[model samples]
Target: MKPLFMLLLTYLLCWQVSLGQQNSYTGNGQVTFSAGAPLDLIKGTSTAITGSINQVTGKVYFEIPVKSFQFANSLMEERFNNKYMKTDRHPKATFIGEVTSFSQNSKEVTAHGILSIHGVSKRRSIKGTLVKEGGKFILKSGFVVSTKDHHIESPKLTGGFMAEHINVNLHLQLIPENVTPQVATVYPAKKGLK
Candidate 1:
């Protein structure tokens, strides 16, 4: 009986450790968006992005607070939250899906998931690079968001200050759940990304 009990305890501990190693969470994630038109350009960035990933299951998830984004101009920020995004009504944008293809040797990954923004969800496939460094997995990706797809109407009243398409970039450093949390290295957006 004592031997059986010890075996069960060992099994449980191993299972728990494996599960923890398979899952990771972002310590500090950054999300940025850029929209440009012939007349003007709009850019915003947020450091409040949060998410988790399971390497074993290939499941990935991320969420960004709508109001967390900051703009260079205060008026533009207010208009973005209240008039455009209606952040009070829909406070978060999220993506939930799985990594369809990933190769540790190649460091290339493709994820298929549902991206939700402005209360609308759309199926999407996003390609990104993933690298393991210093006990962390770094993810970087860039994609475009269409205002029409998410029902974000860009009024002509601003004289084409907003573009119909917005380019988004993400940088995340994820640490395994079992590991001690440490300060993540934040990478700056690449030049000419817009």
Candidate 2:
């Protein structure tokens, strides 16, 4: 009887450790943004997205460097970093929030948190899908960002070449932090951003 009890205790301890490891994940991903006006469309893609998730606490955080985004036109890229986004002053955009609703049986998830861009922070609720496959979590989400909300000024001189709202997309695959994946990188937290 004592031997059986000891075996059960050992099993429970191992299970708890495994559960803790599975609860946290860190990874890199891709982000895309598109702004469409009546006459022109501006789009950019960046693969420098880094994020982490704590499943047990429902905490999620993501960061992307402003200068990392790439555009089809060099002029657009330069204007975005220097004139619009002011990458020299506001170097990164980040989202820090909690998963308000999540279910393992379902793929739908909602995260409520603060999104900071161009040194402006706003409360936002982003809806996305989470899928668990082969011990990794794949998160996909789409949302629109308002230029006014982030204090981004439109180029009036360009005759409405930029839209008021930009469409953003995210595709991320997060793996357990303990495991060393091919592209596992997490950005360090910045001061005053939390």
Candidate 3:
């Protein structure tokens, strides 16, 4: 009985240590962006974020390809891709920076990163919460953006129908041992994307 008890205690101690000090810097992430006008406006989300987070230094960075955006209406999707976003011209919008502050044992962090859209990059300061659980990193970061700033002009048909200052929301779930996330071409790919 003594030997059994000692083994169990040692196992528990090892597990706890592994959860803490064994923190890793390599983790996957995601990005979600949505824009709505008045009525009949569409929203969307994407997961093409790729980057790393250093647990010790509290630095994190990620990237999401511009080609992963999906829309509710098929025609709208094409218009957004071929006209508004011009994904062919701008392939990616990346975020890179360090987490300046966080609470101890809380697992929630406030990270600051830069946002690059179109062929232009801007200094975007973002504040969000993070959790390291199930051997993965989950982040929810959101910000507002001006369509004109990124050169996102309304399509010819949708012109005068959309808003200039659009609100974007991002919810990223980065799972471990997972490969790159592809365009979610499933049913209603555009509903509530961002």
Report the number of the highest-TM-score candidate: 1
Give the poorly placed runs of model 2, Cα more than 4 Å off.
1-19, 156-162, 179-194
Pairs in steric clash, model 2: none
Q: Candidate 3: TM-score?
A: 0.66
Q: Which candidate, 1 or 3, has the higher lDDT?
A: 1
Q: What tens-digit string does per-residue lDDT give for candidate 2 at 69-162?
A: 9998999999999999999999999999999898767789999999999999999999999998898999999999999999998655356454
**TM-score, each model?**
0.80, 0.80, 0.66
Which tens-of-lDDT digit does each residue in 1-194 have in candidate 1? Answer: 54456666666776776667756555559999988763566789999998888877889999999999999899989989998899999999999999989886899999999999999999999999988887788999999999999999764435545478889999998887765333334344466652
lDDT of 2: 0.88
Instruction: Output the better candidate (1/2) by lDDT.
Output: 2
Clashing pairs in 3: 44-193, 44-194, 45-193, 45-194
By TM-score rank, best first, the candidates go 1, 2, 3
Of 1 and 3, the candidate ranking higher by TM-score: 1
Q: Which ten residues in a row have the lowest lDDT in candidate 2?
A: 179-188
lDDT of each: 0.84, 0.88, 0.65
Per-residue lDDT for 1-194 in model 3, tens only? 54456666666766665555444445444555656654557565565567666666776767767778666778877877777778899887777788887875775566666777777777767777777667767777667888777777844325556556656666666444323322223233354563
By TM-score, the better pick of 2 and 3 is: 2
162, model 3: CA deviation in Å? 4.1
